[model samples]
Target: MKFMHISDLHLGKRVNEFSMLEDQKDILRKILKIADEEKPQALLIAGDVYDKSIPTVEAIQLFDDFLCELSKRKVQTFIISGNHDSAERMAFGGRLMKESGVYVAPVYAGKTQAVVLEDEWGSINIYLLPFVKPANVKRFFEDEQIENYTDAIRVAVEQMKLNTDERNVLVTHQFVTGAKRSESEDISVGGTDNVDASVFDEFDYVALGHIHGPQKIGRETVRYCGTPLKYSFSEIHHKKSVTIVEMKEKGNVEISTKELAPLRDWCEMKGTYMELTEKAYYENLDQDSYMHITLIDEEDIPEAVRKLQVIYPNLMKLDYDNQRTRGKAAFLEAAEVEEKTPFDIFEELYEKQNNQEMNEEQKKLIHDLVEKIWEGGH
Candidate 1:
């Protein structure tokens, strides 16, 4: 059985206050095209179908169109809710949709539901474990000791009673231990939300989501498909793709990735203000691409971002790496006055305020005040 694994769609997401709807539409179409060419039996969307719990109308319609087309093609689909998704909303018409070969995992309570599909070899049981927490698991398994995210997920998987004799696939949205995170993902502090990869040892393949970078965890069978488009400047260099998995039988699987091309790529550019503005330098580049530019010029450019927007319409961020900025850091570090005596400190302050050393009369007055304050134990 062949299927495509993708996650973190984050539809209707906006980067730097710029809407990504058009880019999302373009990428979804590309995914459809890949689906057509690959002709996979199913497409597995692990989680994060929308950018927010309450998505915009356009986001809903866009996802609807994608699903409608898949239904038309008679392709099966499996989806689960991520941290950013409202499970109740995502599962609103899940029962009805399942009748048409679309399976959406409901908000997990106690038992995780598995959708069984059969191939020539045998039946492949696909388990859907949506984003879970300790509290969610504790409510159902009152007797189980679910202390953290790992314990919660471990207890939930144990209740599934998975049969090792048959091929089983697990689809979940989680922060698997050791998986690298991108700036775009909302991660918890101190790795408190991490789940161990060993918990999924029984499954033939584990499809994961949540982390924005596509990568394998522990073994080749467990993987995160990543986002289709870069959502932050930190992900400027990511080569986004959809994972393709082909399972012939129990413990026999092949995995590959299909690259996705966005309407405009996310990139970072560094140069002097003059160089960046020169027609010769930027004339051939893709002005529509999202950009994070760093200026290396010493002098500040007035309305730099506004002016750059004329040539690069999608410039998202601007920063300076010039001498003045560098000197400011050095000056701050060198100006530490903790070791100086109060009189010395006052003298430096007087010099700065008056552009000269303190006069004799002023010095006498300050010395008298300091002596009086010291004598009084202040």
Candidate 2:
């Protein structure tokens, strides 16, 4: 059985305040083109179908058209909601859509039934596990002690009663431990949200989402297809593509990717104002590609932004890297709260308030509290 795996569509997303509707529309078309050539029996959309829980009307319409096109091609499509999506919204009319070969995974409620797919090799089970928090699963299994994300997912998979004798494919949305992070993703404090790759040992192919980079974790069978387009300058180097998986048997699987080209590339450059503005620099290039330009001039360029827009209309960001800016002294030290865990920030506050560091016991108490809060204790 062959499958086309993709995720993190992030439809209706705005990067640097610029709407990606057109870019998204273009990419979807490119994916459809790939589908035509590959003719995969099934399509696995891991998650993050929408940029938000409530997507724009345009985004919804765009997806509807995409689904319609897939149905016309008679391809079986499986979709799940990611951390950014509202499961209730994604699962709406799921049963009805399945008649047209679209399987939308329902909201987590203790038990998740796998959709069995048939091939010449017999039946392969496709399980759908939407993005879940420990709190979401803890309530249903009061008897189980779900202390963290790994525990939560481990418990859920155990209940699936997987049969190791047959080939199984899991379509889930979660950040697996060891996957590289991207600037545009929303992750938990520290690495508390990671799900151990060992937890998915029972599956043959684990189709995953949430992280924006396309790569495998632990084993090649477990993979993230990544986004179809670059969502941030950090992902500018990413060769966005659709992952194609071919499974002949339980252990016999082949994986490859069909490259994608967005409407405009997300890229960056650094040079003096004069060099950047010269016609020789950008005249032969696609100036409309979204850009982050760093002006290395020693002095500020008057109305540099306005002048640059004439050549590169899609300038998403502008910055300066000069001696004056780099050599400037800090006005006040600011903590990188985004990079700190909840407990780490709390400890800093405790030390500043009492003019003393917390003891091991106090630290333990706060650490436990932080864990509890993430599990919905507060």
Best by lDDT: 2
Clashing pairs in 1: none
Model 2, range 185-277, lDDT digits (tens) per residue? 885667889999999999999999998999999899999999998998999899899999999877889999999998999879899999988
Supply the TM-score for candidate 2.
0.88
- Where does the lowest 10-residue lDDT sum fall in candidate 2? 329-338
Positional deviation of 237 in candidate 2, in angstroms?
0.8
- Point to the candidate with the largest TM-score: 2
TM-score quality measure for candidate 1:
0.86
Q: What is the alpha-carbon lDDT of model 1 when measured against the actual structure?
A: 0.90
True lDDT of residue 88, candidate 2: 99
Q: What is the TM-score of each candidate against the true structure?
A: 0.86, 0.88
